[model samples]
Every structure is written in structure tokens, then in C-alpha cells.
Target: MSDTTAYSKKTMRVLLYLQQGELTEHQIYSFLASRVKDEQNSSVLRRIAGEELGHAKIWQKLTEKEVKTNRIKFWFYSLMALILGYTFVLKKMEKGEDKATKAYRSLITEVPQAKQISEDEDRHEQQLLAMLDEERLQYVGSMVLGLSDALVELSGTLAGLTFALQNTRLIALSGLITGISATLSMASSEYLSAKNSGDKNAVKSSMYTGIAYLFTVTFMVLPYLLLESYAVALGIMLVVVIIIIMFFTYYTSVAKDLPFGKRFFEMALISLSVAAISFVIGILVKRFLGIDI
Candidate 1:
């Protein structure tokens, strides 16, 4: 029935609204659950599914008669809407996941219900997440991690060395040296490392990651050229470098479809590991070669 007639028809009209709402919720759940795959969220989606199943019972109580023909029509419309909605939401949800990842740490903290969702919602979220993650791993190889790793390693190396030198030009040159050599080496290492893996996008991912990183270093090194005091410039550049790197990392995640939670942990771990290793190398050089501490 037309909406005008639907209004006057009966209380049974709620079934139409309820069914439409259930499908929309299903689409949302499919997207969300894919993003956050777990039993709890799955359970939520399943529960919503159950509620939908019982919705027919509510109809039976209210209408006291069968509307098999109408029910079929409703199912047909729901299915068609699902197809159209899935395609639309799939694209939007991936973007949404990318956007959400930027605030992942806070998003989780902010959305207490993030981990929780009804079955219909879970199914919707899950489908979206799956589509996103499929694109994500292609974008996220170990190379993204490696580039981030290189940023911390080279930045710290340049920072500490420039601190010791306390000469602006030399610091600038040092940073440049560090930037080029580190970029090439890291990119090469990542390329070779990824080459061994079967990921089709590994080479491409590493190539872009290295280029993005090379650019990030340029900014980190730029401050040294402007400032007179090497130590001061190094300190200031450290902050600048970190911010630039983070922006690139977050942006890369957006392009890659990486989830909010996974993205943060992955970025942090890769960077910290690189820093820790570099720190150890610095210590070893100091201990063995009597390099200036």
C-alpha cells in the first residue's frame, strides 16, 4: 500500500517500518561487524536477527491473520534494498573506517558501544570491514611499518648526532645524509623483504611508502636549514619530523583501509621497535668503538 494508505491502514503498518528499520540496521551491522569481528558483536547482530524473526510474531499477534503475499513483497523489497544498500554502504563504510582509524584510540574510548552491536548491525559491519580489510592488507604491507620504523630510526640518529656536533650546516648535512641513506636502505630492505612475500601489492606499497617517507624526512630536515643553533634546530626538527610522519602514517592508513585499533598498534609497534633497535645500536657503537656518547 502507498504510504498515505499505509498511515490509515492499521497498527500493522508498524511491521513495514519495523522491517525497513531492521534492514537498515542489518546493513549497518554488516559494516560494523566486518570492522570488528568478534563473538560479542556477532552475538549482537544475531540477537537483532532474532528480533527480526520475532517481528513476524508481533505481526501475528496484532493482525491475527496471514499476509503471506505482503510479506513476500516485503522480503523482495528488503532483499533488493540490501543489494543496493550494501554496494553504497560498502564504499562509504570503508571511508568511514579510515576516518575512524584516525581517532581509533579515542574512538574506542569514546564509543563504549563500539565493541557492542546487535546481530543485524554486526552483519552489516562485518561485511564492510571485510571489504575494507581486503583492501587494507594490500595497502598495509610490512613496508608501511618499515617506513615508519625508518622515520624513528633516522630521526633519532640525526637528532643525537646533531646534538653532539652543534653545528647547523653539519647538522643539516647530517640529516640529509641520514635521510637519503636511510631512505634508500630502508626502502630497499623493505622492497626485498616484501618481495619474498606473495602480496601482489607489496612492491607498489613499499615504493610509495618509501617516497612518502623521503618527503617526510625533507620536512624534518628543513628546520636545520632555517635555524642557527644546531642543538635547538635538532630539537625543533624532532618535533616537526614526528608530526609529519604521523600525518603520513594516518593518511596512509586512510588510503589502505586499515582499522582504527589495528592501525594505531601497528604504527606504534613498528616505530618503537625501530627506535629501540637504533638506540641499542647507538649504545653498542659507544661501548665498542668509543664513539662520542
Candidate 2:
């Protein structure tokens, strides 16, 4: 039998699809590598790009067919790498390869190269990805500091104000004042902490922390600003806090190799627990002071 006849038609189609995918990924990775400022990260991305091209070449030998990379896919992922950090972009791409990996597994008997590529996907690519260093990830602790504090502190503050003020506009005003003050305080604290730790980018760390806190504060406060009922606004604010926690947890999980479910539940539990306690305290304070504002 001819070497080409060894592969079933289904196997040939799969090989062709893998060829196109690998070539497209190669271009995307190469483009991202060029766009990054960090030399180390650039080197890593370039290496991954080369490995992807090598995979494409292996498939080329099997099919004896040339496949062109998809320009549109390369451009789309390049845009994503530019907007979202490359860490997120790469991890998202890795997740997409799960389906391809399963398909390759099915063709391993007829295509030895498929088994090798699958192993590379599971071992080499994942290991290299774990070694990638992105600037945003370097300051993840600062972001966590800001995000956790804002979710816990602001949620509690809003809940307390909801009962104490009993008016949406008044509650929003009070929460804004408190949130602004806390944001500045948290930023200053993080700056000092980073500086004391001898971090060269202390200023940047503080900026990231402050920006994260400020964004969370703005989002959580928006419902109260827009709605007229304090109860409804408070309810919506809590929901927003949960969403922020979920997204951040997921992002951290993918970038840092942490577990999403545990992190998410822990953060949500703490933030909600604080808010619930503060809410009860607000009711007590309102009654004890005979306040009606």
C-alpha cells in the first residue's frame, strides 16, 4: 500500500484541519510575541510559535498538502492579545485546543504524529505557558488587595448605608464618600507595602490597586445612583459584587493555575458575610439612634 493510502479519508480531513489550526496559531503567537515589550515573554511566545509551526510541518508530511494560516484568525487573536493581556489570550487559546486534542486522540492509531502532537500539547505547551511572565500577572497581588477590599468593604458599607439612610440618593452619596476615602487609603497602604518589600514598581503596583478599587466602587455604586429604592439598589449592588468576584476569580485561576470554584466561593462567602453583618448593624444603629433620614 502507498504511504498516502495508509490514512483513512477521515484521518486525512482531520490532519488537514489540524494543519490549518497549527499554522494559524503559529502566526497569532508570533504576532503577539512581537507586540510585547518584555524580552523574556517575547522569547517564550516566539518559541511557542515555532513549536506550533513545527506541528504544522509534521502534518504537512502526512497529507503532502500545504495549508495556509488564516489571516482573519491571526488578526482577531492579535487584537485580543493587544486589548486583553497576552496571558488571558493565550490561556483562552489553550482552552480552545481541548477539542482538537480529543480529535487527535481518536486518530492516534493511524497517525503516530497525532499522538506526539497531543503529548506536546499536554506537556510542553502547558509547561511553557506556565513559565510565561506578563506584567499584569506580576502585580496580581496588588489587584487582589484592591479587589478583595473593595468587594468586602464597599459591600458592607453600602449595606449599612442602605438601612441607615433608607433613601437611594442619600445612600449613594454616603457610599461614594466612604468608597473614595477607602480607595485612597488602600492605595497608599499598598504603595507603602510594596515600597517596604523593595518592589521596584511600587508606584505602578499602587496604581493598579487604586484603579481596581475605584472601578469596583464605581460599579457597585451605580445601581444606587440610578435606582430610587434603597432596598432594590442594595440588592443590585450585591449582585454586581458577586459578578466581579466571579470574573476576577476565573481570570486568576487561568493565569495563576488556581482553582476557580474554591477561590470564587471563598471570596463570595467572605464579602457576603461581611455585608450581612453590617446590614444588621445598620438596622440596630437606625433604631437605637431613632434616626430617620
* TM-score between candidate 1 and the true structure: 0.46
List TM-scores for all candidates, in order. 0.46, 0.92
Q: lDDT for every model?
A: 0.54, 0.90
lDDT of 2 by residue, 24-122 (tens): 999998888888899999999999999999888888888899988888888888887787689988998887777798779878888766786788666
lDDT of 1 by residue, 1-293 (tens): 43233323433344444334444444444444444455564555454445544544443443344443334433543453354332233344335444323332332343333233233344654563454333334445454555565567666766555645556777688778878887777777777776787656666766766775687678777878898887677567656755655655555444444465565556555555554565466556656776552
Candidate topping lDDT: 2
Q: Which portions of model 2 miss their true places by more than 4 Å? A: 1-5, 68-76
Error of 2 at 38 (Å): 1.2
User: Model 2 reaches what TM-score against the true structure?
Assistant: 0.92
Error of model 1, residue 292, in angstroms: 13
User: Which segments of model 1 are wrong by more than 4 Å?
Assistant: 1-126, 133-137, 198-202, 245-293
